[model samples]
Target: MNSNNEGKMDVLNNIDDQFKELLELIEKEKVSSFSMKHFDRLKKKRKTSKKKWFIIGFLILTLISMYFILLNEQLTYNIYFVFLSFVRLILIKKCVNTTEIIKQSNITFFNFTKSIYLNHLPVIIDDATDSWPAMKELTLKKLFQLFIEDPVLAENDLCYFETNIRNYNQAEGADRLFNDYINGKRRSFIGQWNNCKRETLKVIRSYYNKPYFLPPSVTQTLMGNWFLVSAGFHKGTDYLHRIPLNYDWVWLAQIQGSSLIELRPKHPCETICSILKSVTLNKGDLSNDCFFLAKESYWTR
Candidate 1:
């Protein structure tokens, strides 16, 4: 009995010692893991801090280089004068007479060919868009629906937007515009969406008839569709502005809201022909129902 008891005591002592060693091993392993994790975090933070400093240093160097270059060339003086000239032009306000744009109502296609086109003057045809179904059928909601169906059209991501009416530099996507306009998420001004596919143009053309004023000799070298969506006022601010001159003739069909259209001749024509014409176009019956036919010779808004 004594021999058996001694053997059992030895076995119990060995098990307890093994368990203690196992716990010590586990504690050492946990401490090692914690140290490794702490070291990794410190390394990442240092890398991020280094990257930020590098970017700041690069930008400072670029600006200093640009300043020295500008100083050497005396280009800064030229830039200042150009800016001063623009400011001077804006400050000078003259109460000059603005001529009313020429309007021809109920005119036959022959008269349009002779008077407007031959003379190369911008005119408002009050009855030109009378037969266009788009004047009746097209709405803001319908315009969004037209392009939203095709998965391919949604990929048209490079859309021009006017953040401020005076500046047309912002760019966004048509899909974003559709979403913003429909969901009432954001207020935006949409500009030209050019280079439309033939299938897309065909769909849009079905809503509107071609102008009868277009001469039979006129050939369409390029077909384009521009969707201009705006609330007339952006963020409750108003500024006088003009559309940049497009070197081609443009027929603007105002399907919905009223816009004040102003036409002025090119800079060179300012001396000889100082004619500035302004007109208001509203969509309705024959009298107010009008659209603008802008010639290449004028800058219009």
Candidate 2:
């Protein structure tokens, strides 16, 4: 019986030794796996660092090449200047052709639609406001009188008064009293009136209609439900400066004034300012207004 007990104890000891060996093997495997993972991470980081350095080196090389080329007077004169001049010539030719096409096509409703919606171009339609009675009745004198009678129309904080050719962004703007602005000819302009309001002047609202030349689809899509009006005594000086808008389309009607308009293509490389088209708009003429439209995706400032 004692021998039997001793044999059982020996068997148990052997099993215990085997279990400890297995545990040690598993621990070694875990260590090996952890080391492999750490090595792989280090390798990946090295590769990423190399890629970054390569990109930086490539950029530095390119910039150095450009600097050297620019420094070489003969190369700059022959290559850079020649290429720029050629590009400028092409742009000028395109501008001329575009202007000629606009003049030949005339400013009909069909042409206006095609130009804005289809061609994605700017167009000027003469005498667009001739039919409106406000053109004859809504003179500067009448506008001043209306403001005087109804001060509420000019009481809005958004109303802007410009005293010089410099835009409000470049210089400080003031909210001049409507009565004072009209009474004094300080060569200023008053604008930023929301004519769509119910309390808006009746005279101003009388002529507020959708541009007859605009297609129904365009007006509906762009929400052409409101008209914004600006009145000023900018006879000799340029009053309206470049004002960028996020709207898909803009229809500017010179209800009772004449001004010179300079249009720049959205693509800066497409045309030079010297060769760009300049349009002179005169009130009472059939082409007193212009429409500028751009596709939502293609629109620039």
Off by over 4 Å in 1: 1-98, 150-152, 155-162, 165-172, 187-192, 195-199, 219-221, 232-245, 267-270, 275-277, 284-301
In model 2, which residue pairs have backbone atoms overlapping below 3 Å? 125-287, 126-286, 126-287, 126-288, 127-285, 127-286, 127-287, 127-288
Q: Report the lDDT tens digits of candidate 2 across residue range 17-103.
A: 999999999999999999999999999999999999999999999999978876664454346324533544354433334442132
Among the numbered candidates, top TM-score falls to 1
lDDT (Cα atoms) of all candidates against the true structure = 0.52, 0.47
TM-score for predicted model 2 compared with the true structure: 0.45
Q: Over all chains combined, what TM-score does candidate 1 have?
A: 0.51
Q: What is the Å distance of residue 11 in model 1 from its true position?
A: 99
Lowest summed lDDT window (length 10), candidate 2: 292-301
Give the residue spans of candidate 2 off by over 4 A.
1-97, 100-111, 159-161, 165-177, 184-203, 217-241, 267-277, 285-291, 294-301
Candidate 2 lDDT (Cα, whole model)?
A: 0.47
